[model samples]
Target chain A: MENDGMQNGNENGRESAQSLAASPLEVHDLTVSYNRRPVLWDIDFTVPEGKLIAVVGPNGAGKSTLIKAAMGLIPSASGYVRFFGRDLSESRQRVAYVPQRTTVDWDFPTDALDVVLMGRYGRLRLFQRPRRADVEAAHQALQKVGMEQFANRQISQLSGGQQQRVFLARALAQDAELYLMDEPFAGVDAATEAAIVELLRQMRASGKTVIVVHHDLQTVQDYFDWVLLLNMRLIAFGPMETTFTNELLQKTYGGRLSLLTEVADLMRHEQRKERDPL
Target chain B: MSESQLLDFFLLRQYNIRVVVLGTVLLGIGSAAIGCFAFLRKRSLVGDAVAHAALPGVAVAFMLTGTKNPAVFLVGAAIAGWLSMVAMDAIVRRSKIREDAAIGIVLSVFFGLGILLLTRIQKSGAADQAGLDKFLFGQAASLVTADVMVFGAVSLGLVVGLALLHKEFKTISFNSDFAHSIGLPVRGLELAMTTMLVLAVVVGIQAVGVVLMAAMLITPAAAARYWTDRLTVMILLASIFGAIAGYSGALVSYLAPRMPTGPWIVTAGTLIFLISLLAAPRRGMVARGLRNRRNSRKTLEENILKTLYQLGEEQGGMFNLRTASDVARRRRIPESQALRGLGLLRRSGFVEQANNGWKLTQEGETQGRRVTRLHRLWEVYLTEQVSIAPDHVHDDAESIEHVLTPELELQLEALLNRPTSDPHQRAIPYH
Candidate 1:
């Protein structure tokens, strides 16, 4: 019986490797820490290609940390992330990241078009300026998000919804196979939210993968095909039909385990004491 | 001076004058170029702090090297500025102190250290220290040809480097996290930017000095911001402003022969800033103030128009001539204000003289009807849609009536389905 179980495990690992080749994103045993305290621990997941996925969790549940760590924006404590069965550095141009709108200086002196043009920076060789074709591509992206009319307006003058659209236009200009967005719907108008969802569906239909850090629980069933429910650690991740149950949501958002929180607090206290003893 | 001498000076052929002007101009361009990024990052004060921090470095370099070499001072100042930034970062990360407090602490502490070093150097009574005091407030007239050449070359290098890496620098400054996500080495770009800022501060110290160089970095950039919203345009305008400040400051110093160049350059830059603040299109204080005044005046005229329409309606819509005192009483305005309103109305052809009082003209009657219609429509809409008490909405409607355009009036009418009366039973005028 032991021999049979070992053979079954090897076969399953091989099958997963094959699946990883087809999936846009695969993470194994990922852990992220801030100031020596783990925010996300032992996270393992795979995102199916050409599917719209939502990563949902409570505040401080490390939903943003998961995305940032996978994109190498933040250092991970352990494990690695692969894009299409390859390391991120090897597949960078094929991926794009749309950061939260609030993360940047809105008063920056560039217009909508110039910002979208920055999306092409990754493809340009060093010391080479963007050409006319790059400008055309940026204009096309702005048109896609219906922000072409605002192409010349400085970013500071843009309304919140319009600013969010400009950021999405920048992401579209990247023309990548995989897209990751953090809170694209937060603080946007209802119309902008609808436009973003429509754009995501279109991208999925075109065989592009999109992952979003979504905060609205009410719209999860309507907006996403797959869901990853997380609260500091992976609670459940699968197709929304099989997962996304009330029981799993309760586990993810229900108050943290008293014992687990107590342990975390104690560990943090010990680490602080070790760093600077009184 | 002879005409030929004047011509020579204008042509920039004189060695001393040319060197001073060229050096100062180059310094201006480089500082302003780098300053654009610093200002956008909201780190304008960092330049001031770094400049002040350079003082102790200059003193220490003099003490260690036993010479007054500009190169030594440059290296020393760069190190000091870079160290202050590192310390500030550490304080912010390791302690609970916020960024503003950290910067404030670093600025004052470093500046205090610099003052102490300067006093110590003065006490030592070194022979070469005669000109070192000039660094406190620069003397552009004292810049030698060699210094001019070095400054010019470095300025060119700084500008060229920035131009070559414009996209990368812009990306990092606007959004570092996004840049990192795209594998752009944000940390490395930041280090390079900081280094460039330090270099800018260092080169500017000779002409603007540690005390006033910060102004050169920030004032021109700020002034340019008022003129244009584009970063490229703002940088170019700032460079032009800086060059003007430098040239005129140098010229004045040359003419006076005793005044320092640093304060004058800063003063000139401040003058440009003042002009931009008061006169720049769209964003200037004067333009905004004018727009507001015109709007308020128009509101007052429309309110008067509505009052006249109400009086005419009370007397069967004939607009019979009413006395000034009566108009004032009905409108609850002072007699003087009523007379002024009447005079303005006559100028605009909205009212005409009739015996002892003013009466609305045909055009005036039309406008009066529009204003009264707007006031009543707003009152009705506020009471119906916003759920305001009928009595409480008059004040809001009074203000809204003057500001609502024709399109808004149409929309309100459509929404309310052309209500004939307000909740208070006042007739809603229609055109």
Candidate 2:
């Protein structure tokens, strides 16, 4: 059954490639709602392969929500997201997600190496333990992030930079073609920042796609080749040189879209009414 | 009971004793295994609510079936427990009430309803309903061989189920979104985990009772967390702790005629938790207190060394008889503290007491200069790299000087490019 699904996906991928070379990620008219109120609205974009993309916006702009919705971590209200011309379920092995560092409890009873080993779980059969090769791959991932010495250390004992590196190492162990990271440099030290940059450069050199939810505007031009300017809606998205203009950034961050916000507020008010039905 | 009687009870020679102990031990292991996930998920109190909700089911099953068959009570309890969880989730999602409030509502309402039904059943004057009240406070003494066999089998099944899905549980418990993004069927796995948790509660309810059963579920896992940071090891330790609690509880109740088994078991679990909280190596309160004391002592010693080094510089780098009172007044420290600091330095060969006061030996001078250098180097690094104001750097440098290792000192030195002095314009001391 799984083979049939994979073959169908491959055929579909080939057909899409014939028309317009299939980008690494494609989302069309995607709208996501939480608690009956929309968080991301009518998002549409296509991401080029083998480029470092930064999704930049202000707080509550649904930057993490976009990545999560595209990966099917949360259900979309309307529209669809396709990866390599296929649904997420069909292409999960080719994609990896690095959630925010604060999303997990570091006090969970696990060491750095064990966390990295989780990256290989998607490839294993049900009820199967990680084999020796998986452990070796996890170790290699740890080494790549310069965290091998601390691999045996409890996760809670790690400093902020070290914890970020461990998270990055987990993503690297996945060996996915596309990596979506949320605020990887949020609290990391300079060394970890450099290590992450080097890792991203290597990934791009090897023809893999990376999309990061970036908060620092200064490094946007220097680090990313492509930019997706978002504020509850896609303001602009393209190569950084052409798309990351002063006007677009001003639009994304300037809070000039008050009409949109007002409409969203009205919709939320109605949603509450519908839920309560009194 | 005498010591020999205690020995015989512990040896499992008595059939009834063996049955009760085995039942409670299996109950402990099962609750703890599933409880680890619940505890990690921050749903520790949910077990308490679920166990409490099962009480009404017990009364309802007894009223309807008019028999004490354990299977009927199990099914009834499972359904009620599941319903309470569902209600709690629905209330949280559909209303402005938060999860804790929703849980509070469901736990109390169901528990209250159970009490009402239990009182009604008592008023009904039915035969074989005499011991149904024991479910409120468990009567492990009433547990027969057949009851032990059934409870043990179910508990074993729950534990084995957890083992089979250990990786899935770990992933979801750690990061649910990552698990979902990886196509791990996170919701279905959560449902499976919840089902096992319900089964665990159901199996243990007869031995620990609904009132105290939550302690069995959570205490062992919380205690085990202090011992290790590996999920598998934590689960293993939790199981062992749970078993020990069960064994001791059973033994105590067996030996004492009037003692209730449920309270004894809960007390044992609490005792284990207290021991782990106070004595476990890395996470324990005692170990942390000791570590804090050592750090503070090192800081104090370094401060005294720096004081001595400055005093020597003022005296043209010659040994002088500096009384403890003089040093204490200069450093603004208590005289007793100065004496203690000097005593420690003396033992370490950093200072020697003469007739008038304490003096720094040649080795003491070198050691004192190293601490001073470290203090100055950190101040420079903070001002230069961390961008702290020159005036704001001294206090931080004071505490950090004692903790900075040799490698960090080298890095700070290189980073500062061998600055001759700190931002304070004081000449950087060197050994």
Candidate 3:
């Protein structure tokens, strides 16, 4: 705690550090820019432990950038991220990330079991290979996601849902205290979505924090206990019942977003008619 | 050449030939091994640019050292090759120009400069520079023991580095974002991959030259991809392919007098690729064509069977004989197509010719019933579960019925509650 306070440098930041030390993740004055344009502006929040949280926003709203910037995968224009009030580098082992499914080439020459084996690589020393114990642990992780039978199956041959499950299995093998998943539910089948939700619940029961970049607005209340409404800025952040109100949702997705959706839909309709000559 | 000459060439009996062959073989093994990483990284053309860039360095190194030393060539080539890689990446990152254009620009500019320097050096009449042009197409026959040692050590170092860092390499190549999040030095690992690629190209440009060095990097790796789906196995197979091409090319040059070994090496690699493209199992063009033919044949035969079964049902009998034209009319296909299908079924003992017409055997009746049953099940599922219009279900179910497996059939049955009739009021047979 003393080290965390000193790193914060100012009395105000030190006060917040001491208060946020009990939380799993805290972001203070976070702003992320891409190509000299700020994608996320002045984001600030501290998340509690053992809660399933969702970050929801419209297209081009910097949802993924927040997660990447917080994990130090992308440089932030301003502000910093802390896990348990410590720098990300100091507590990286306690945090895990599942990137969007499209970020990787699924057609890579590897199998499900081998992809899962990557989860254990962080614990291995430099130039060391995965051992028998690591292999056994990887198997257990796959079994937890109901993918033990497809362990030897090549990744490209797996269906969309199965590929998502393999990704989840890889994250499960990390065995971390806090998980950051980017759109894990996108393009997955009903069964895979259900399995992921069940796994998230189990993780919550064990006092592990899970933050998801959720896309489906219809199931936000049903899937997560906490909601962080964002659209290039923090609109609201609190318990799902209190913060997930229509006013905040409207504030996040108001005006330009709805008009944009309408124009896109109109263009799609016109294109379909043009294709069929109707 | 006679058989003994061939044997003598392969057995390494000739000292000069042995040195050249060892150098080329090691060149192949090293380039192809590291080439797998480059292939997966989609940086195959970077090798070409690097190799082309090395020529200028070789000409400069000779001018500075005033020697034809192989060690100096390697140092010069490696530096220039590494520089080309840096330049290509910097242009791609800092400008609007695409990677392909950057590679093209770097490759041609560097190669053009090398040729300019080479002409200038030749005009000066440096007697030791007589064979400097061999670096363009390579002089495999002129490899001395020192040259062989230099090439062999560098090539082997590339292979050893690949083996030692395979894990980190795989993680970074497959998913660098995830690797970065997990605390792996992704930027450093990328530099390592790039360095190995440059080293492989620079070491190989001596034997394969700048023009054909990319083949050593791309051909064996492409052929290996069709043979396996595992990275380690692909690397192993690619190295073996490269080694075969290496020695075979050297042997061809030895026997054919005046033929260049580098081109022959690439030719041997292309031959292997052609064989893999046509003959490898599962992914090969020939195998896919064969499977497609078998599938269409099965589909035609089953459709004919179903036609016969339906005609029998109209007549209230299972084994009534029907003419080929009658079968064709019922199925709305040509008579010849129906006859061919019946002929194929007769060969398989599913049908018999008797009384100037064809009749199904007992086994054929059971098979026909199953196809009909699958069609009806799919129709029912489409209409009852999917809520599609009843009339639209037949065309959709027709194609799907042929490919549905027994497990899917059982699931469809369970999902649809084992209905006795489809949406069109056709009975779904159960066995």
Candidate 4:
């Protein structure tokens, strides 16, 4: 059954490749809502393979929601995500995901090596345990990220950069064709950021795809090959040289600045009214 | 000591011992297994609430049925215990009350209601009324072989359930978000965990007594954490500790007739906890303190080496005690400790006294330069990567210098673009 799933997934992937040669990931007319209100609307874009792509937007610009929707992590109101011409689940084993570091508990008792081994779980049968081969793979991944020495160290004892590298190693251990990283650079030291960028470059050189949700605009040009500028909809999606312009930045972040400030003021007004009644 | 008397004791009194020992062991195993997960989940206090909540259920069962059958009362106790858990969760979910506060509120209120019901039951005058009173503080001497068998079966069931779902439980506890993302049915797994917790609590109430059952659930797990970080090891250690406590408690209660089984078990659990608290290798307080002291001594030695390196760079070779003391003062070391640190450094052959002054040996010079190199590299990193101001980097880098590994120093050098100078434009010698 597992082999059949892989075979079917590969066929679907081939078909998708033929349809969109320029874009390995294609999202069409995507919308996402939360609690009856739309957070992302009318999104459409495509990312080509083997490029270091950045999903850039302001704080409330649905950047995370867009990635979540694409990964089938959140319930989308409408739209379809095609990965190499296949549905998300069909190509599950081929895609790797790294969530925000804050989303996990660092105090969890597992050591650095244990977490990296989890990347192999997707390929393993439900009841099967991780084997010696998996452990060796994990060690190799850790070495690539320069965390080999700390493999036996408890995760809680690591510094921020080391912790982030551990997560990267786990993702590398997955050996997936496409990588989806959520704010891999956030809260990390510069050395960690450099290491991750180098790793991503290596992944690109190996013909694997890498997409990251990046926060710092200054490093965007240096880090990513392609940029997906977003604000509720696709502002622009193309090579960074062609799409990253001041005008596109203004359009994504312009109107919301004053509007968000006004909402904050109104909230403060309502809170005051509740407290003072006058 | 008579033969018949001994026979009577063995035959008649032996049943009590069997019941108490078996019940305590089963309860210990069940509660410890669930407790391992609860301890990891940071919901250790919830076990306390469930144990306390069972009181009202037992009381209500006796009130309604006018019978103190262990089966009937335990059913009611389990329902009430589970309901109290639900209520505690609801209060936290719906209200602004924190989880601990909710637990405290539900625990005291349910227990208070149980006491009220117990008083009412006493007023009603029933033949089986005496049996209900034993639930307050467990009367292990009154336990029969049937009760032991029931407890054993329930505990075995919990153990099997936990064994089957160990990986899923671990995934959920460590990273619930990832578990959810991977389509692991996190909610169902959580419910399974909670159900096991309820089962552990209900099965334990008759043996350990409601008042002390929470300790049995939490203490063993807490102690086990000091011994191992792996979940399986932690659970196994906890179960073994619990079983020992159970057996010892029952044995003591049987031999001395005056002591209650519940208190004896609690005492045994506490003893294990105290032993773990003082002795466990990694997380134990004493071990951590000893490690800290060793690290501090290493730091002090490193500081002396760094001081000698600075003197060598300045005078082109070595420095005296006065200059060393002055440098140590600038580094915030007291005069007495600084002198002691210098003595240790001299004794260690990293430094030597010549012409009433201290000078770094050839080996000392090499170590000193490495320390200085690490310090400057860190300063450069702090300024270039972390965006710290050049002037502000030295103080922080001073402390970080002692801890930076050789590999990290190399990474820093690469990251800083192999700068030959510190942020302050001082020449950083790299060998």
Candidate 5:
């Protein structure tokens, strides 16, 4: 029995190694537009498995749009996201996404445990409620985030950090191999930031890939192992130590300031013309 | 009246009572079920629009068919109501007009057209059209067995559909983006919810007129919110309230010969709303006021204890009650409460009577200095990091000090760079 267990472990390790060699998340020549105006130019990148990656860019640099496009939440002009060597639709069960904290209504009449149980809805039948096993998994997820005491509390009563922890708990209950979180650290307290970083580290340690859209350049080194620098186009994609530098940051954020400013001005001008009809 | 006389009056001549009871029950259940989702989505007025929009359809149906068949008129009304809702949505989406404005526009235009049609039909020499006009205000006492069956079937269908699609409806209402991301058909779910709303309104029009339907949709849900923070409980409570109002309205209209059922139903709904508003446990207005008053009294008592402790800390482990009173004056606490508060402090061992004056006990001094430290720390944090004006910082700090947990105080300390003095350069007392 011991030998068989060892063999099983060995096979799992080899399978993971082969999967990592062929990137788990691959975006190929992706281009997106809003109303026929380019937002993201042709972009291509691949995120290897079991790594904590950060996608960092300036505001309006398509940081959020990139994640939304990849998740198939929004229509893309031309591109596709492959998950585990398949399209996103085919392998959606193996993926989990945590949207921005502000996107959900806090005043909704649900407790912390109820929201976490939503993660199991994809696995359960449409008309069914969460089973005992699903409930246990939700409880375990809450415990992992140190929010077990708040499971029965109304979501409206939670502080900002507690709310973010609940979102994380929901994602944890999904038990997916790949996680995509959009700005988990934004507006959170320092303790929550540390806790979330630690959670992501644990996910990476468990041989699961986690991609986070992050702000705050100073904490990038402390949080993420891999980095994808974007400025509406693929600026660079590699290990943080190799690709994250002043030159790349300048190219991604600094040099395009005037061009972005011009585009925004033109958009405003077009909007005014449409409104006035003169 | 004699027993036999009363029996005859109730048993045989009390057909109106039966109609009222049955009609109210169905109307209440149906409206409350649909109202729960409408309230949740913050589209409480959509029911109002659809109800009013049905009026013209009812009149038009009568004018075309030349009959008072409730089913035919109701079907016509439902089609009209649904079309108006669709038009309103399209206008809001295509144009820059806000949803509220679009609802107002659609409601008034469609309803005005309905009134015009009713007036024209009445003038066209059809005596049966007189009864059709009663639908505008509702005549619940006139409901027959057929009407009850229609309402019961429709209400049952809505409730069952809601039960089957409960999870999907909740997901879509609470978080549309998340629903879409998870491959839930968001548009289909929304359309299903809207269809249920239209059906509820169509069933309710015979009992409550279009003008009063909004009250039925909004009141029960608003009342239910005061009782529980769970969706299932809220929906159940709302349905019960709705049913009570519906039944009462029907009963009143039956007992009184000429009274309209819609207004009576609305009156019952309003009464339930008033009870929930004042009597609910957590979110009720009266409960919140009581909690606020209790918290204020506690804050005052904590302040008095801290002031006495501060006096003891300054005067080397002992101070007279006069000195504590003077410190309270500096903190702007009223002298009368301060005295009464000092007496309570003495009972609690925070202070003791000695030589015709009060002095802090060991425990009292520890707590006083801690409050003082919290106040000074908050003052420093506000003026240094938050960049509040020095004068503005003191008032905020004074209020915040009482609520600051040790964990939060530490975060404030780190955020303010661990300053030893306030912006005024006064030394901050520390434990």
Candidate 6:
């Protein structure tokens, strides 16, 4: 039974890969707008397998927007995304996302273990509690982040770096193939930064694809194997050795496109006009 | 009712009173259990909006059906509550109007409409409208067995739903973004939560009415939160608190003349919340105050022991006793605080009183030495690594000495190369 299962999985994988692009994440002409204001413009990229990819850009360059759109948190204006040559819904169990820590209220009445157990929520059906195996996985995930001692600590009682580690542990409990993290190292201490980098390398070594929205450009070349430079639009994407040049970094952060903001404002104005029509 | 009758009622000798109490408690449990989620979501005002918005539904249900049926009122209230939620969402999404403003608008508009309809119905002189105005502030005294059954069944359903969908509810309340990313149907779960809130409000409209119904939902949850960091324990505590408030309301209304059940229930809930705020352990005011006092006492005790040790060190023999006045002269703290600290330390066996003077015991000597070492080591660190002048480091190190852990002390010792003396040239006592 085991042999048949393994063989069937490999055959299915080959069939799916041949049917469509086999990239871990593939986005084509992705456009996302809030109301009528466009944030990301016609982004096109496909991440290679088993690499630590950094999405680097200036502030308001849609770095977080790209991840949110890929996760389908926000509706894309026009585009399609494929994960493992299939839709996100089909390969959802093999995907994990770690949002920015600030996006949630840390004062919520839940502890580290309870928060990590949320990673297993997707695997359970409706009206089902997390199984013993799921709790074990969550505990193991916490240990991996060096937060096992704080397993019962309230989120509000944790320091900033410890809270970030708890969030990473939650994602680790998902045990996914593709990981999308938003600013995982932002505002972290040196120890937390090292731990996160180590975790990312381990994930990459195990053939899991990791994508991060990175802020520090100096560390990008060292931490990421691939780089996708964005500033409201896809500027360049390739292996970090070639694409992370000084000129490209300047293009991404130096003189941003003022036209995108102007057009976004105009689009919002038009949308308002259409709404009232008085 | 007489005191004896009240006693009988409390002892459950009365059947009608028992059912009525059970109904109110069930309603309270349902509302407060879900209210924990609403409270954590920082949407406490939404419950108020939903309750107020439920008023018109009860009125409209009666007007449409011309019967004051409990089921009909619930349906009407549920519909009105649902519409209010939709209206609030639309106002937030479609326009720049914030959610609070939308809730305020919807709550007042729907309640005003319900009042207008009720006034019109009262004037029409409909026979069934005799006690229709009771929905305004609830008439717990008039609740029949049938009405109690309706409230009980709906409240049970809400409790069951909360129990079954706990994981999804907690995830969404804590972080909807993560829930959405994990494919847990974030919007649907939110809608479910609001729907449960609507049902809770609908069930509460009769025994507690619209105005005071929100207290049953919010007060219990708010009080329960101070007692626990775990959501499950919080929910259970909220249920217990709500049930107590509900029982208290039933008792007051039954025994006292002119006391409304709804307001009594709310008053009782407020009392419970106040007690929890003042007396609950860990997060309560009394506990926090005690903890702070204990911490400061330890600091004082440690400082006193260090002072006595330092005085003895300067005299060449560490076992010699020092006068309290001499001990007080070494530190800048108040004399009373030093004496008090010394008294506490002596009682704890860290120090002893001998020949009308104080001396450190062996335990106290070790502790004082550790504190002294940490202080001097920090002074060295400040001057060497932080570039602070030696004289300027003493004041900063004074407060930090007591809080430094043994692990940190080791780290500092390693980092400072086991400094022989502070910048003041005094010996850094080795433990």
Query: Highest TM-score: which candidate?
Result: 2
Q: Which ten residues in a row have the lowest lDDT in candidate 5 chain B?
A: B5-14
lDDT of 6 by residue, A1-278 (tens): 21111111222433334444677887777899987799998877667789999999999999999999999999999988889878999998899999999999998888999999999999999789999999999999999999999999999999899999999999999999999999999899878999999999999999999999999988998899988888988888878877898888888877658877898999999988988897
Q: Kindly give the stretch of ten consecutive residues in candidate 3 chain A with the minimal lDDT sum.
A: A1-10
Please, what is the whole-model Cα lDDT of each candidate in the order they appear? 0.85, 0.86, 0.86, 0.79, 0.81, 0.87
lDDT of 4 by residue, B1-431 (tens): 36764454446456565577778787788888889889888998898889889999998887788776778877998899899989998998766699999999999999899888888888877666876656666766667777887788888988988888876788778877556544566788888888888888877777677888888889999899889867788899999998888777776656665556778888999999999998899788899899999888878878778877776566564544435566566567787776777778788888787666566777777777888888888888888878999889888877898899888788788878889888777678877
lDDT tens string, model 1, B339-414?
A: 8888888899999988788888889889999988888899989889889999899899888888898998898999
Candidate 2 whole-model C-alpha lDDT, 0 to 1: 0.86
User: Which digits, one per residue and each the tens of the lDDT, describe model 2 over residues B332-412?
Assistant: 999999999999989989899998789888888887899989989999988988899999998898778888999998888
lDDT accuracy of residue B279 in candidate 1 = 100
Q: Candidate 4 regions off by >4 Å?
A: A1-52, A69-96, A123-128, A131-151, A169-179, A198-211, A221-226, A232-243, A257-278, B1-15, B92-98, B255-260, B308-333, B351-373, B376-390, B409-431
Error (Å) of candidate 4 at residue A73 is 5.2
Worst 10 residues of 1 chain B by lDDT: B250-259
Worst 10 residues of 4 chain B by lDDT: B315-324
What DockQ was computed for model 2?
0.75
List clash counts for every candidate, in order: 0, 0, 0, 1, 1, 0
TM-score of 4: 0.81
Score chain A of each prediction against the true chain A by TM-score and list the results.
0.93, 0.92, 0.87, 0.85, 0.86, 0.91
Give the TM-score comparing model 3 with the true structure, all chains together: 0.92
Writing each residue's lDDT as its tens digit, candidate 3 over B1-431 gives: 79999888878998878987898888889989999988898888988899899999999999899898888988998898988888898999877699999999999999999999999999988878987777787657777888778778878898889888998999998998889878898888888888888888877877777888899999999999988999999999999999988888778767764566678889999999999999988889999999999999999999988888888777877898889999999989999999999999999988899969999999899888999999999999988888999989889888998999999999999988899998888788899
Each model's DockQ score: 0.61, 0.75, 0.67, 0.30, 0.49, 0.72
The positional error of residue B276 in candidate 1, measured at the CA in angstroms, is 1.0
TM-scores, all models, native as reference? 0.88, 0.96, 0.92, 0.81, 0.87, 0.91
Report the error of model 5 at residue A60, Å. 1.8
Give TM-score, chain B, model 1. 0.92
For model 4, what is the alpha-carbon lDDT of residue B160? Answer: 89
